[model samples]
Target: MPIGMILWRWDYRSGAEELGKYPKELDVSDKTMMQLYSQHLYGAQSDIVSMYVGALNIISVWTGSTHNYFLSLLLTIEEQPEDYKEVISDLLYYLIPFIEEDTFNTLLPSIYQRCTEFPSTNLEQRRAMMYGSNLNRAIFKTLSEEGCFYRDELKIWLEDILKTKLYNFEYIIDGLVQNDILKTSIVRGVDGTYVFLLKYLICFRAPPLDLSQKIKIAKDNELNQKILKKIRDFFKKYVPNEQDNIEIAGYIRQTNYWVIIDFLRKSYAKHSSLTKLKLHGVDQVMNLVNNLINSDIVDIVVDQNEEQVYFLKSDIILDFVPMNYMINQIYNMHVEDRKPDKLLLSYISILKENYLESH
Candidate 1:
């Protein structure tokens, strides 16, 4: 079937009549397309459509719901289990790209509970427990609140709920710490109680400082020393001497390698084009590339590249590059000229295709 025809049929059945109101050839953002598709799928009377809609609703929630669409859809699906398998498939497909392993495990159990009412069927029960187990493990690995609570505290929390022992609690905590989701810190309280701070293990967000301000802040607060000490201590405590540099280098390489390659490729492509005169200067390109490379969303790559440069590979790159530039350009352009610029739009499209294809 033609993709458009299928979409249209689905839309009509799902009550997304407004989607049909748009001109047939009019282009829309992916977000708009998904929203319209969801509204249509959700509104349909068919069991299949309802199932698909339920899955899409779960995707919306995991990706940080901007609305209550998922909650409404969940309510709708709770009344029907026969319609759930199709919805589960759709949810798996749509949400696969948007979630991390940990987050999916954490959230899927709750989703299963709502979908199947603690399903007693062997297959259904297995799937529900698997999702819940995975999610809980992931959450325990990543979130400080889940990891730092002492064995006694953990036992109290799990008591009748989990029927697990103190040994099991320690095992889970150790596993999470090994996975880099929980970090240990020596926290000195105001009352002089020195406790080990177990907190979410995450990379630091970039300091909100411009060039001059960054320099001043670093100098005034002796931030460099503190940062160095933290790094030194973390490595000394958690990393064996033989593994310390290798581990840190791996992180840097994963994050920066892709941005460097892309910058080089774009530069080469632009230099060969007739539009070279209109392109940003080398310095400007370098600055933007540096900023993107250093951004928190990127994973740094450090190994020897066959192409000989650093790069970043993250889903955020798809949204970040164009959205960052497009908003500023749109502000300066007239409404009639507010369409996404050609290069930025092309880049976003390519990134999206690559992203979708990967998963």
Candidate 2:
């Protein structure tokens, strides 16, 4: 089938901004794109269609502007349902490196919704998938997956992972850190050298500060004597709500509710900005994460690994343990009709007192 008619019909003017986004001085060459997408494209008369489409897609990704070609790639789930997951995953592979902040944040939820159609791909997905690769595994894998390390330690680790020497690697490091995706700590040397060390990444799923502030004010009395019952019901209420309760709710409360405490533990991890949710019962866990996110108990979500990870707001306990906060406010909602758990009944009390402590 001719792809030209499809894109033209779908995008034609795409929008009025089309002409303005592309400047003639950029000196884009047909050979450049042909060589880049050689694997996906063959030298055919039909190649003209792909070149135009490719230009639009790259333009959207870099400039944060939405045109039909970029929109087509995003709506692949609805438009091209066959093999949708693989195609979307491929888009994510290279999309992260250059996607503009507004474009990424606004469209990601839509991208993730389609992603939900398939089963869990991997819990090991990392933000590194968004950057340049020398045609192999992503080079930033170690930084994303590994825990705390010194500046020199990371340089050596990257060399080991990429299997080559990195010359003037600081420039590369500067881009990764400076971009809105990741932020690093600034340290200066005695010789006036500047070294950027990865501190934490900003999860795209994070809630806005105003949401947190509004939640804090509105739900002031969320934690009362009845919180124990609410906590117990959280595990029991959602257990049966899922279609496949066996795998999804296997760890609900029957397994001693390890997931709840573990989430708290992840908050204290060196990364601090994001907490990796255990995938043992990802289906139900995600359901719970969504609830917490709405309740303002958690700040954000990142699904870079196909498995979802969340950000729990830690500042609630940063200054002092107040009577009301995200952790305790989790117990505010009402429980459904389910027998109360004797163990979870008392577990809430311990979680409240030891808000700072997690095992």
Candidate 3:
């Protein structure tokens, strides 16, 4: 018998809840492929087809729709050529890449450059960004009504909304700060914490800058920053036709990750009641997920139910979609009364079998 052959149910097993929350796999290879693909980094003589396939695979995962569904999406994107610049503003998290060490420290500057460019693309993403997170709404509401907020002051307010004590709440604040959704103003003789004051936010921003004026500034800054980015990129990666190649890759990798990461963040945050960049750090996460395709060799055999199992000497199979996400998905489908997914059942059994000496 084969795994995923029958309609296996999760509720029938012990530790059913744990099994449902088991992490999906994020293969190391896949992770690297995604990062490199995002930056338009590829082999010296890489063919376009390999690149396209990876992009298609990424888009599929990002959309929660199938990878095969990208032909029309890609076509639509291509038809609107300016579409590449379209940034999803309320992206739940933006990866803040922290390089191990460097003389020039090009990575951080590159990210800053990326930041100034996003608003330039259009306000469509801003509209999307405005309403995506509960934290965003709470912050907006507090700032709207109170006209200014202190960090500690805001947390007490949120605790009331959530009906539970929030841990690591600083991470939520950190994410907002890093993403530029929030900025800080230090009080004169107060505790010396530079919290984002609402008046400071609206004062300089609202009166002097009209939307079109802001867009023009962003667009000009984007062009200048783009040049700096390309110069840095060309010097570091230095390949012929790199910019054109990156343009192609950006369509699938860089821009859409904005879309996909937002989607994934929203999905996970919904059930977990957390925001981005807390569970996730800047590229330090490498854990096992159940559904990832692995190159590891382990036992392969059929169980009594005629389902196949994967066993390793050390523990169960490991892949990397970050386990908590799987839990979120299970809760979602369960509440919606959808048919059970076969692969999900397979994942459950595989995860369940992980602790057994032999199955």
Candidate 4:
């Protein structure tokens, strides 16, 4: 029942580099993993296959150095001469399971972008429902008999989407509130408004405004001292008062360390000559330097008389953190929990053996 071979075959697609040359002798014509998995697993075989393949594509698109295979496929799928509707729906369904929590966080932006392209009323609603359901499942990690978002569920949903790009604060607030994604009067509350602004700052990493500037904006209208206090508290929580070695993984998870790493990686990829990257806030930058060094994701170099700098360690494998975390989770489930998912364990094993052995 274990589909170890599928994971083994799919391992080659997981890297950040361009796809490697496929073996000439291997055959994939008669059965595209769909036929094979159909025989072994429950549920629609085609659905599972599409989800797995689409996940590989998502991983590639998210991490690819130069090209986006997902977008390219989207153009092709959209223009399909026949069966376009079914293909799009199935693709959307399969994609939900594979979405990386840290990368997309919330599925709204991803789903919304695609829905806007199709413009079908029914399709839009179906996709919205699918996205909302999947998001709820992801947040709760289990389905409730009654399908509805409770107050706490709505709060988590808000926080997740808050991390995504918000072009207009007022419009988003009104829309979400009106749609019952948030409490009707939540936005008007001091704590609620403050939380929103703090999230915006963290999410965007916008250029810091001085205390007077921030307070001026806060006090200029209805927003006031409570807003400023929230911002100050966020700085306190994220920024350290004194120098200390941070617990790397824990700190990264708490403060979205992946975002910082992604930013640095993109900068390095853009300018090959750039040897160092500078970041702001928290104890001449607490946690990042030590975290990067500990993760082996970057090389730390100190200037003779100045600040420390970080260089991306090119040989270090991409997808290390998430992939390793996944592998560990599977191992724990199998050995520690007295329950085993042989298929998933096989996938993790093949992935690690093929690409992560060095790590």
Q: List the residue pairs that clash in candidate 2.
A: 125-305, 205-300, 205-301, 206-300
- lDDT of each model, Cα atoms only? 0.32, 0.32, 0.31, 0.31
Compared with the true structure, the alpha-carbon lDDT of candidate 4 equals 0.31
Tell me, by TM-score, which candidate is best: 3
Model 3 misplaced regions, further than 4 Å: 1-26, 29-122, 164-181, 192-194, 199-359
lDDT of 2 by residue, 1-359 (tens): 11111111112243222211111123333343333234133434211212233423221111121222232232221233333433243444333432433344444443444344322322212222221133212323343332123446566767786675544244345544454222343223222222221223221212224433444454323321122233334434432221232222222222213354235433321222222344454345545655544543443433334333344442111111222232222233214312123322333343444345422
Q: Candidate 4, 47: how far from true, in Å? A: 12
Compose the digit string of candidate 1's lDDT tens values, residues 1-359. Answer: 01111111123344322212111453333444455446434654311233334223221121112211221123232344344443343343333423323244355444443344322233322322322343333343322222123334444565445554322343344443554333333222222211121222222222222322333444324433333333334334442231332232233332233333334332212222312322432334444445544642222222222222222222111101112233343334434553234423343344345346545
What TM-score quantifies how close candidate 2 is to the native fold? Answer: 0.24
Report clash pairs, candidate 4: none
Name the runs in model 4 displaced over 4 angstroms: 1-232, 235-321, 341-345, 353-359
**Count of steric clashes across candidates, in order:** 24, 4, 11, 0
What are the RMSD figures for all models against the true structure? 24.2, 21.4, 29.7, 22.0
lDDT of 4 by residue, 311-358 (tens): 344211111112233445556556765433444344444445635533
